[model samples]
Target chain A: MTDSWLTSLITATPQEGFELAITLSRRGVKYTQPDPEVLHRLRPDYANSADSLTAASHVIAVNFQTVAAANNYWRT
Target chain B: MTDSWLTSLITATPQEGFELAITLSRRGVKYTQPDPEVLHRLRPDYANSADSLTAASHVIAVNFQTVAAANNYWRT
Candidate 1:
């Protein structure tokens, strides 16, 4: 696992594609189906590309305790 | 560059160390320092290890338009 999470995609048009990407991001609600412990929510205020939200890899978000608990639960 | 950013650190104790690490994370303000365009901010609500923050590698936060703009500015 390396304690990392990564996801990537190449855009045909960096600008338009980025807009679409973020738009889709906004369009999508943060949810963790099958894993209730994990609640995926985008960092608001980090809205605009110029304001916040830059070109970086996958975002890191976790409910570690829940994750650990869930992990334990599953283990049990 | 592979269009990616990466940073990593190994912890001695995953639990206590994780708390300390996140405490340090909370203590620090999101700043780009030299690169004003690259605004760094954490995804909130994602606070507790069980709440949101997980043992994932570094988080990704960016202001791409500013990044591109700043990039162009520096290039000019």
Candidate 2:
């Protein structure tokens, strides 16, 4: 398999993120909690919403081999 | 504290992400591995960049208490 990947974000309550992490990991899908620093650097909207974002919920950054695959995983 | 928050994404190599996770966690920052399904659902660009993004590196989603805090963490 290639060593490249794409990234996406999912904002959810800490409770939901915790549950999803378990679900995705069991399915052999890869993901990570975004580094607030890194997120601030990459996404402007994230930077703008920092306080609200951190105070209430968490952000999850997911990886995938293809857009279709990522879409399928999320939608399904 | 209120229970609402925003979200964002950061794409990087797996190596860098691992290291940053260590650094942030040690500093008392909370984070987690993202669920790819969740990401695909949230960010459309991520879906669009799937091929190139997955073929190159990983994505990181970070959280913070404020925009300035997130910026300070990432920039420093």
Candidate 3:
């Protein structure tokens, strides 16, 4: 849990930036729910739910926003 | 590009499934725009836009839905 996967958000490309955004979101979820068993148990309730999926996407987008800001929107 | 990062969508845990969903969404984008330069150029256009961010989120949600179905909603 202490291992750092994120060294920098300043990616050389948008693709990397987007990937970083996903990583950030995933890490956030892991931080919030460190217990894999509990997360697995709760998966059924939210997996098929459109609302939950949409919510997950929203979180990713927010992460993307943060990454974008960090990278200055990849502007030269 | 030939190296496969996706082994399975049937994760042992929901967290893993969610991460896979994010990967799927990211891969989709990469497929759509193989050129990093083009994607980077496009970043500024969508980076600060609420609609664009929301759109990205929606895409992730859709990918999540696919992963959920593939994993049978993680119902064991």
Best by TM-score: 3
Give the Å shift of residue B19 in candidate 2: 17
Best by lDDT: 3
lDDT of 1 by residue, B1-76 (tens): 1232112122233343344434323222222112333333244323334423332234211222222222232342
Q: Where is model 1 chain A poorest over a 10-residue stretch in terms of lDDT?
A: A58-67
The order by descending DockQ is: 1, 3, 2
Against the hidden true structure, what lDDT does model 1 obtain?
A: 0.28
Q: Tell me the lDDT of model 3 at B5.
A: 64
**Tens-place lDDT digits, model 3, residues B1-76:** 5555644445777778688767766565554345677556566655677876677667767666655655667787
**Residue A69 error, candidate 3, Å:** 1.4
Regarding TM-score, does 1 or 2 come out ahead? 1
* Each candidate's fnat: 0.03, 0.01, 0.03
**Model 1 docking category:** incorrect
Candidate 2 overall Cα lDDT vs. reference? Answer: 0.31
lDDT of each: 0.28, 0.31, 0.63
lDDT of 1 at B7: 20
**Could you tell me how far off, in angstroms, the CA of residue A24 lies in candidate 1 after the best superposition?**
17
Query: Comparing candidate 1 with candidate 3, which one achieves the higher TM-score?
Result: 3
